[model samples]
Target: MFEPEKQLVGEWVLDVRPEEVRVLVSGFQSWSEAELRPLTDLQAVPMMKWRHEQGHDPAFLPSGEAGVWRSHTLLALVRPDGSGWVGCAVDAAHTFTHWEARVDGQQVRVTCTSEGPAVEVAWQDTADVIGTLETLSAQLGRNMNAITPTPLRVWCSWYSYYRDVTLENMLDNARLARQHSLPFDVFQLDDGFQADLGDWFEPSSHFGGHASELPAQLDALGFTPGIWLAPFLASPTSKLFRDHSDWMLRGEDGQPLPVGNNWGGPYYTLDTTHPEVLNWLRELSATVRGWGYTYLKLDFLYGAALPGVRHDPSIGRAQAYRNAMQALRDGAPDAFILACGAPLAGSIGLVDAMRTGPDVAPYWDEESRRVWLGDATGPSARNALHTALSRWYQHSWYQPDPDVAIVRRELSLLNHHERGSIAGMLDIIGGLRASSDPISMLDEEGLALLHRCLQISTPDRPTTLAQSFGGAVTHFSRGTFNLTNQSVTNLPAHAYLEQRL
Candidate 1:
């Protein structure tokens, strides 16, 4: 019954239900309206979900412009408080028609930018976001296609090992896990094993050209074989770059565009729309999955969908992005796809889990840049915790994977207090939980901390807004566990440190 101000410039109707709300927006000044061309009769979709994308850029913004905004995806609205939630049913698969939810204070608009005549959107609220999401998960997997994600207490070679991890490093870590009888579900080989960014089939020189053996060895050790690949990015030093310069996505000037400065120099994007690149990706996907690795962490995935001059100019960026992901799905439907640095809305249903925040570095604090980055900087543990907690609602559908929990006393810049805080936050967030520290390098104290974290679970959804104290002390409660940056003295143990603008 609430009508908007005259200045709002649109006629809108809302259907409010007990569990959810549906908004039908029409009668705005569209080009079609000017032409008086009526929309054809079609069945309105039953389920429309929103996703608060933790976009590629650290400062995630809802953007319709391609490449400029790599993160926020369709139905980009979030609950904004208490339990910190959002959910998507994946019905919008390859069917985005500019379903961006622009929020202004309490007011928001869902605009239809594509050829679609109008936009139909849905919003649902619940005390337990995960409970609702599992229902959707079951619904999503009704055909029994979606893979159930196992709790990933992965022994990842990221923070401690990074790109320096070799076959020896992985074997030594796996050996340590076996000797100590450590609890690890997956032994992941992060970035270093690849011969080059685009050469997924070849092993790096560090591995003596047999990286495939690493996965089998880990599996024999009673752990799932996990591997990481930035499938969309090809490094300048890669064979793919040298062999097929035409495969690279070019800007309007016909020169290859650099995605970002990651694997040394600026990495070039693979034109997913190109037939050669598409087939290459398909073969790569099948080869990796066929190698018996159940877990694949696809990183820098935003590059796949960035706005650029593609082999086919007719396709939209999102369309190109979906096509690339669909190729991987066609190749490996059963593998658990953990999307890292992926475009938020573009990856629903296509991925089993997503790295919803920047990488958690060994260094804990970002006080100097805290004001500047404000939870958007990469390689920050505190910023990761902040982002994970805020976008937690997405955990109800695809799992929210905050990066790793580093507790090793050596080679880490995080102190005891910072380490404990990060572990606590990860446990509370309830997604893929992994320790990047090598157990062999960990002291008794670090091992004990990991043991305690394994016992922790997601807390009950909080009903109140997170209270902030001075700036340093902030906390929120999940029900089973409560996490805080630091214990808020003279107040409660927690305060919600989500975002205060």
Candidate 2:
């Protein structure tokens, strides 16, 4: 509970509990004090008797079970002038968590630690009190739904040649996404779209010189047009590299520095410190915007800084992202930028979305194949839960994408039980992205599974039951319940959950 010593104009109470927390603000007529629930709760499957002990717990338990006995913390704010606004923050050090909440007379500016792993809630005079709160609730609720272990939004990325799929095939894929009632907002055309990686202009054979038309068609089909571009990257073979070699980040020997691992030859990083680089990026952004792309997934952003580079380390990683982000904003003012392979801290107040995990491969066998692969194993799942738990609070206009949904795959690749386990985990992460090819390939049962994953809402209660190297399980419950692990060899993991009926 928070009770300020000063004779403040208004009083705010912040209640933190093991399962959930609520914030009540008095003296404000617009928004009655409301309870903000954890988004991770929605992902918990039925379970009874779930609790965390100091030891002897299952190695990899769900969040609800793991976080039960964890210590929690809360921070609250008050407005002295009777302005009906307050600032609030909450964190659980056990999880290295932080979150920010803005209570405007009506709306609340709420960003959870689980969303960005950091919280920034401040009162802006020009803010919309009611709207902000509504948005906060909606965003938080979306995360809750994600954890509900149900799929809400079904999306796919257009990596063009990377996936060995074509533009026409992508259009067909869009139709299939809508067929499943999934709103495909981003039809991302990855690196292969441009004639050369550096020449941010001209379409390739894969796109058939109809890059602009592709997204427009997708929009007509009710999908948002999304394109992929590493604003800071330039292939040595690119025309831009030939013309602006000076703009590239140079090594100690004055040679262009290389960044990514998958790509064969060397690529240069943009010297964001140079005004020319910023100007060129802005023009490129405008060009992409002119091409009718509304969503931009900025990749390879971490390349901006290298270990022994001649860059300003004083401003730090966060500022470097800010510089690039500002350039992006100037380039496409209305574009939605989703940060990928970039540090989460640097993306605050800049990007509209972020990839919480690494790239997920289409294969189901190799652990290191995809970005979310680490999340598939018990230990990786625990790490993912902790990551999601730490960042949930930061979700707002900027959504935290835990990475792609790997549920639907060729039957030969994964079995039903394996699929169920993956499905259950996807619910925990919340936001999802799928490849273009798989969207069209899903069968009836597969589509149904995907839909079920989308519908689960965020849990009303947020708690961690147990965490271990094998895996961690968290639970969110609104009533008396019990959860047990049935991971006996050759048997499905089962949980028995009961409610007061």
Candidate 3:
């Protein structure tokens, strides 16, 4: 319980337990009555769908104006001046926890809600924002029993070939790897191979109607075969959605709940709580693993947890998401599973690796951010770096995949310095090293840069803070390099790593 120096304005019944909690904090002064003034105020972390979200912005200072902020399972009010700060987080097991803060006039009201876990809230007082976060993340990791796997260097076909990837393109990259002796551990076929989002069993026309043979072909080239899928999503035109409408999560009106707009139109979420859906998920995982692909990248997983009337009404959103994950794990026990666009706390112990940020584009463009009206969760180099740098503390729970390292200049708009900064930033963070560049088209320098980025040694658990000194410029010191000029999609984007001896 938080004992503030100021009198409590309003309160709600807090059902406290080891795994969940729900409380309403209405109108209060600062967490502490200390004399030290705050340099900047308020920090909130997003729950999931980090793309195009505003809660995790470093330059976010909701001091005077009325504003609302939301975090998935944690919220913090930090005073970076070494004064006093308060951090609140909940243990999300069978529940999904979220914190929403509303600033009205001079009063601030924060409500912490848990969909279903046994209520447990952790309150801490500290000025060290990063240290407090690290401690909390570690505690959550222990509670979830998360696994940290050795990161693998991967070559993906997403940004390189996009949805137009063909059998020749895969083979070309594979042959280039063999010829150049690239030490890539996995060769992954991204979204293009699948016939549709929900129909994962059949290949699209791109592979001449056969993707199973490519795994063996990739294995022959000395790389483990990998694949990508949005296991919980079903496109409107998908056979799964057409044949089994009951498997889809529904709204109060009994219509399929629209998860998001992608793959030509709106897609829907599968109700993992549905027994048949869980069985299908398990069979899907088994089929993929049986194809000899050992690495799996499950993406757009937030759809599974979207609010809807589930088959099992007792299960909350986070638990529903975990149910699908458990089925996949049961079916493919030995395969490495990478969770992307997933609820952070819901996926802690289930996945071997997790994408810690948005997709990385080939250029430093913010058109998506502009189109989304300043949603920082879009595809861009700056957005990727900013979010990854902010969430790097999560490396304790699983291998942090900071998307792909785009280094090839052939199809990119990133300048030399910008590319170098991105490579340097990822190298310092030292998470999963992956690239989507066509190695066959790379010049010697580009190849060398790709090689340099892949030659990364995972750092010990991070304790250093990534400080944003205004203008979206963040600094995090690791090894001999310090990331200094990274932006959070607010300013003209550029990244530079300054050496600190």
How high is each candidate's TM-score?
0.74, 0.60, 0.83
**Segments in model 3 whose C-alpha atoms lie over 4 Å from true places:** 1-67, 86-90, 101-111, 460-473, 479-493
Better of 1 and 2 by lDDT: 1
lDDT, ranked from best to worst: 3, 1, 2
**Candidate 1: regions farther than 4 A off:** 1-91, 95-119, 123-148, 368-370, 373-375, 455-460, 466-487, 490-501
Worst 10 residues of 1 by lDDT: 29-38
Q: Give per-residue CA lDDT, model 1, range 378-419, as digits (tens).
A: 467665655555444455446767777777888887776667
- TM-score, candidate 3, is 0.83
| Residue pairs of candidate 3 with colliding backbone atoms | 17-119, 20-118, 20-119, 20-120, 21-119, 21-120, 47-72, 51-377, 52-375, 52-377
lDDT score at residue 38, model 3, on the 0-100 scale: 18
Candidate with the larger TM-score of 1 and 3: 3
For 173-274, candidate 2 gives per-residue lDDT tens digits of 777777777654566666666776777676666655656777678778887788788888888878888998888765567676665433565566777777
What are the C-alpha RMSDs, in order, of all predicted structures? 10.5, 13.3, 8.0
lDDT of 3: 0.65
- Candidate 1, residue 152: lDDT: 69
Which digits, one per residue and each the tens of the lDDT, describe model 3 over residues 322-390?
A: 889999999899999988877677788898887776778887757544334444455777667656655
Give me the candidate number with maximum TM-score. 3
